[model samples]
Structure formats: structure tokens, C-alpha cells
Target: MGLNLRAAILHNVTDNDQGQLQDTIVDAISSGEEKMLPGLGVLFEIIWQNSSEADKKEMLETLEQGLKR
Candidate 1:
């Protein structure tokens, strides 16, 4: 089977603590590298999959507000 980018990225960070996860996200954003986007998208997908309706709503609202700025 071909290498799965999403699975690879998720597995790479699966054991991370909250602080480590935050650092990974911050580093990815601060570096402003397009290559980092897939990893971030994977992380977001995980979050979206596990989130409750209210949590998803809040996230959407936050994203919408950020985009409007």
C-alpha cells in the first residue's frame, strides 16, 4: 500500500501532550511553510471528528471572526 500522509502525520503526533501539541501548532504557523499545511489539516480533521456540536459551532464562529478581520 502507498504511504498515507494523514495516518503518518497523526501517528507522528499521537503521543504528544497538550503543551507539545500546542508547540507543534505554533511552530507550524510561525514557520509559514506550505508543506506544513497537510499536517495541520490532519490535526484539524481529528479535532473536527471528535468535537461536539457546540464545540464545532464555537470553532466555526472563531474561524469566521478571524476571517473577517
Candidate 2:
């Protein structure tokens, strides 16, 4: 299969501004459809790659706390 999900996702979001990106995340999460997970994961991957060590640690802590709920 020649399908590259990451490239496709990035292409779709290439022109998105901050507000548009926020809406994309909010919509995907609020909808809670299983299909949205891959997109969310791709977004997270981008975020993770760009984040600093401290930011990554904070995100991990926040995720850990949320998972306990």
C-alpha cells in the first residue's frame, strides 16, 4: 500500500491557523468517533516532536493525571 497517512494528514492541515487547528482537535475529541483517533495521534506526534523536555514532561504528567480519572 502506498498510503501515507501522516503525509496526508499534514497536507490537510498545512494551511490551518491556530484557531482552525484548535477546532480540529476539539471536534475530533468531542465527536469521540474511533475514526478520529488516527488524526489525533498524528497531531500529537507533531506536538511531541516540537515540544521541549519540560513541556513533554508536563504533558506526560497531565496525561498521567487524566488517565487516573
Candidate 3:
């Protein structure tokens, strides 16, 4: 059977509270493991999908500014 990684990642975190989700994200980023990126991308995809147009524009601007550094 093919594993649906995005679905699996979402399922694992579906019941998490805000603090738990924050901790999970912090831990993954702090670990600096390349393996964690796909999971983070999945989470970002969800955030992007749910965000308003203004919110997305803000995010993009912030991302662009950060990339210039």
C-alpha cells in the first residue's frame, strides 16, 4: 500500500491543541533535520489554504524580505 505522507502527518496532528502544535513546530525547526521539512511544508500548505488573501500577501512579503537577508 502506498503511504500518503501528508494525510498521515495531518492525522497525527489533527487532535493537537494550539500549544501542542506550536511545540511540535518549534521542535522540528530547532532540530534542523532535513527530514522535518516535508512535514513543515504540509503544515504551511494547510495554513496557506486557510489564510485570507491579505494574510497570504503579508506572508509572501515577509518571506520575500527574509529571503533577501
Candidate 4:
């Protein structure tokens, strides 16, 4: 189920705008909805796996801001 969802997200995200898609996913995770949290570990792992130091920093910052909201 996770792999399937991830694949679908990847496809859908890449099909339109890459940057906004990335932000949307990150925002979803940061929101920490009950349903959103189930696969969050995987998403976090994937983000850290693919992100550079700067990107990771930005992601963390974004997460912090989201938490405040």
C-alpha cells in the first residue's frame, strides 16, 4: 500500500509542477494529520535520502513553520 501510494504520488506530483508538489507533500507531513502520519517515516526517509544539506535545512525550517501554524 505504501509503495503504491508513493508511486502514485511521484507520478502525480511530477506530472504537473515539481516544486509545488514537493511543497504540498512536505506541508501534508508537517501538518501531522493522523492519516498523514502513518507513512510519514517513509516520506521523511525518502526526503532525507534524496535531499542535499541545504534542502534538508529548508525542509526542517518549513516543518517548523508549519508546526507554528
Q: Which stretches of candidate 1 lie over 4 Å from their true place?
A: none
Q: What TM-score, computed on C-alpha atoms, does each candidate reach?
A: 0.94, 0.95, 0.96, 0.45
- Enumerate residue pairs that collide in model 3: none
The candidate with the higher TM-score, 3 or 4, is: 3
| Model 1, CA-based lDDT | 0.97
lDDT of 2: 0.96
Model 1 per-residue lDDT tens digits across residues 4-32: 99889989999999999999999999999
- lDDT by residue for model 2 over 1-69, one digit each (tens)? 799988999999989999999999999999999998999999999999999999999999999999999
Q: Rank the candidates by lDDT, best first.
A: 1, 3, 2, 4
Off by over 4 Å in 3: none
Q: Write the per-residue lDDT of candidate 4 for residues 1-63, one digit (tens) a residue.
A: 246876655565555466775677788768878776535555577669999999999999999
Candidate 4: give the clashing pairs: none
Name the weakest run of 10 consecutive residues (lDDT summed) in model 1: 1-10
By TM-score rank, best first, the candidates go 3, 2, 1, 4
Which portions of model 2 show Cα errors greater than 4 Å? none
